[model samples]
Target: MSYRFVTPIPKRAATGSVAAVYSASARELGALFAPHLSPAPDLHAALWAVLRESMLAGTAPRARKEAVAAAVAVVNRCPFCVDAHAAMLHATGSHDTADAITRGEAPDPLVAWARSTRSAAPDPWPFPAAHVPEYVGTALANHFINRMVDALRPGSLLPGGVLRAPSRRAAGLALARTVRRTITPGESLALLEPGAGPAPAWAGDGPVATAWPAFERAARAGGALLGPTARAAVLEAVAGWRGEHPELGGWPGSVLGAVPEDERPGARLALLAALAPYRLTESAVAAWRSSVGPRGDAELVRVLGFGAFTAVSRLADRVAVVA
Candidate 1:
């Protein structure tokens, strides 16, 4: 698939760490997300590591987490992920549930909770406390993926922008074998250097506990491209968000008023990706590119991806506190 911001590293062209991660990820999941991430190789590996540990390796039923992924995609308005994960949810043998999710319906309590993750906290905490790591990880993964896909890829997964029922069902059938395959935890961690951050209180000692910090660290590297003032502006804006989706308007434009004229483009792009991605515009990206002399696709993806992930990470922290 052609991407908007970055050229995907084709499988045949992948080398070194990117090659290893692409091979393992394709064998385990599929090629959709990893290719889009290949421009930033460490971010690619770190995210795959998080998904492997949280979704693929968990003892909790993968089907439930798949459901959560789809539901979160729905809330985020990321059609690419909603369709992709709905197919994966179908591969888990929850055919009716997957179909319902594709129609924008929450088929169960777990899915309902996932849908509400951005807007509302779960009061009494649902599900077995033991399943927190897997569930939260899955939601966080989709939250990040949804924003990236929205910013980078087309809304549909297949060629010609097709995403009808028949095509979705066929995609599910193709993924069934891999979705049902057994995977070992922490396998993808080999791609990352070990870090010292302790697991968050919500994630016990599971592989996800380690994987999330790694993903966050790699993602945060994008902030290096942002001026300190720009970075602080984006974070402060995200902090003021009430979890409700922001209405499209002058706010994304005005929020960056404090940013220097030269830095506003990048800062604006980051803020939109984090709080209101659907509001992103062609002019917004063009502005950033016009200002950046030599910083190309990798830098663009980093700046936007960092913003998106930071928002979701904060949401995960909120979920942890409520739980």
Candidate 2:
């Protein structure tokens, strides 16, 4: 199969029904990133749960939130996300505004704020102080997921006009519905306590604020599985990276070279898989899968997801601090 996946997709039988809902939505959207997550349902659920709270379960109007999401998608160059978010805007009778955002135009101050953060610019908090939490949190959350999905999806993604027709827009709205219903705001925190991690003060005191703990839990889970040496190497390899730019950032020359040669490729791939998947290659995927065997594949998924969560959320921390 040419390594259709480096890790097993979250199967209904393996991950149970709750994870299956995420699987179904991912399949429906052709979301390349979701298959990689099936191996770690809790992490996957945690990611989406945070996004749902930050973007949806807040005081911001639904259309405005979708517009904010569309703007973030435009900056991340994720057409699939642009479509999904734009359609949500359309469903809320803001199709014109959605159209503008998909083209990279900042329709308003809030959308502009999201774009500024993408370029590592200051988060001026153009919107109300109360809205900053969800807005910026959504920015940070989508930035993480967009990187993973864009890295895995085909170069030329879905066309923009598919939803131009009224009926097609309705279809997109339906897709968004499936994604919304997958997990509750705090469903991922069912077994864990909120407010466990000491996050930055800029974290909005909204539904999404608790995401810090979920992300912390995911990082700890992967850290436990990977051991200290691998964890340190991954962090060192990605030092100084902000996880904003799509390209590799200050990639240290082969951080895993100290390990066994056979293990080096897997270790390095794991680092990029976590920090910058846009640089992932089929050869690398093939090598890592072949070397790791099946068990290593699942472990790698946890490592990458956790790694991305940390890197992406770190950007959020910085934004919160600066703002």
Candidate 3:
């Protein structure tokens, strides 16, 4: 079964940080997942580092973080991420919570807060102040990843899209042992450059604080693929957003009118990725690919990843660590 919109590096060909992250991720997810992001090794490493530190390696219960990941994926309308995370949530023995969440019910305050993180005013951080980094960081990471999955590969992480409960439970069972393993914090930080960027104040002092900024730095590097006009257009649009779902009509197109004709495709694609990734379509990708000529898939992944993280950062900035 194929997994990406573009060609992926054969696992054997992965080297350096990419190889290391893939090996680490496979221990939990059971395969060399995220092949599309592998083409840009730094971005892949940074993303995995953030995800590992925040989701898989924190003092906060991994179940709560998995709930956050699943909620965030639901907000983005990413079925693929929802399935993956919900299964992990189940693996953590929160079967009732997992079932409630998959049914679109918020089973607890943490789950409710996770669902609200994309709003202009998210519910007061539901956990202790100390947990802000882990909880919020997990949400931000999924916010970034859900968009990448939506734009690049919009389907089940499971084989043949078999999302039945039996399959989901089987997956949960496969991951149960690894889900309970203790991962040391900050181990993934070795993959990041020192002082790549400042951690968010809301993150407090923790490995998540360190990892989130580094991932942002690596992901934002993709914005360089856009021309000045196109890049500015994406930033401006994202800045003005207020957590509302875009009106899938003429909205993004209306905003891109002032951008240069040649730059619209990239700008449009970026805007959709940041604000309404569910609206992204094949034609939208085709337009960007055609305008940019024969650039490789890594460039495209970078641009979309940049747009995704831009929104993730914007929303994450608004999250307050209420005691």
Q: Best candidate per TM-score, number? A: 1
Candidate 2 pairs with clashing backbones:
10-38
Clash count, predicted structure 3: 0
Q: How close is candidate 3 to the true structure, as a TM-score?
A: 0.93
lDDT of 1 by residue, 1-323 (tens): 67776788888898976898878877888653458788888888888888878887888898888898888888888877878887887777888998898778977788888887887565345788888888888888888888888887756764334436667778888888998788988788778868737778877887888877888888888988888889999988888776887766668767878889888888988988897776777888899888877777788889988899879877876777766
Off by over 4 Å in 1: 158-163
Per-prediction tally of clashes: 0, 1, 0
Models, CA RMSD each: 1.9, 4.7, 2.0
lDDT of each: 0.81, 0.60, 0.81
Please list all clashing residue pairs in model 3, or write none if there are none. Answer: none
Error of 2 at 236 (Å): 3.6
Q: Tell me the tens digit of each residue's lDDT in model 2 across 4-70.
A: 3544453445555235445534543324335555566666656665666676566767667677777
Q: Report the lDDT of model 1 for residue 109.
A: 81
What global local distance difference test value does model 1 have?
Answer: 0.81
Ten residues in a row with the worst lDDT in model 2? 1-10
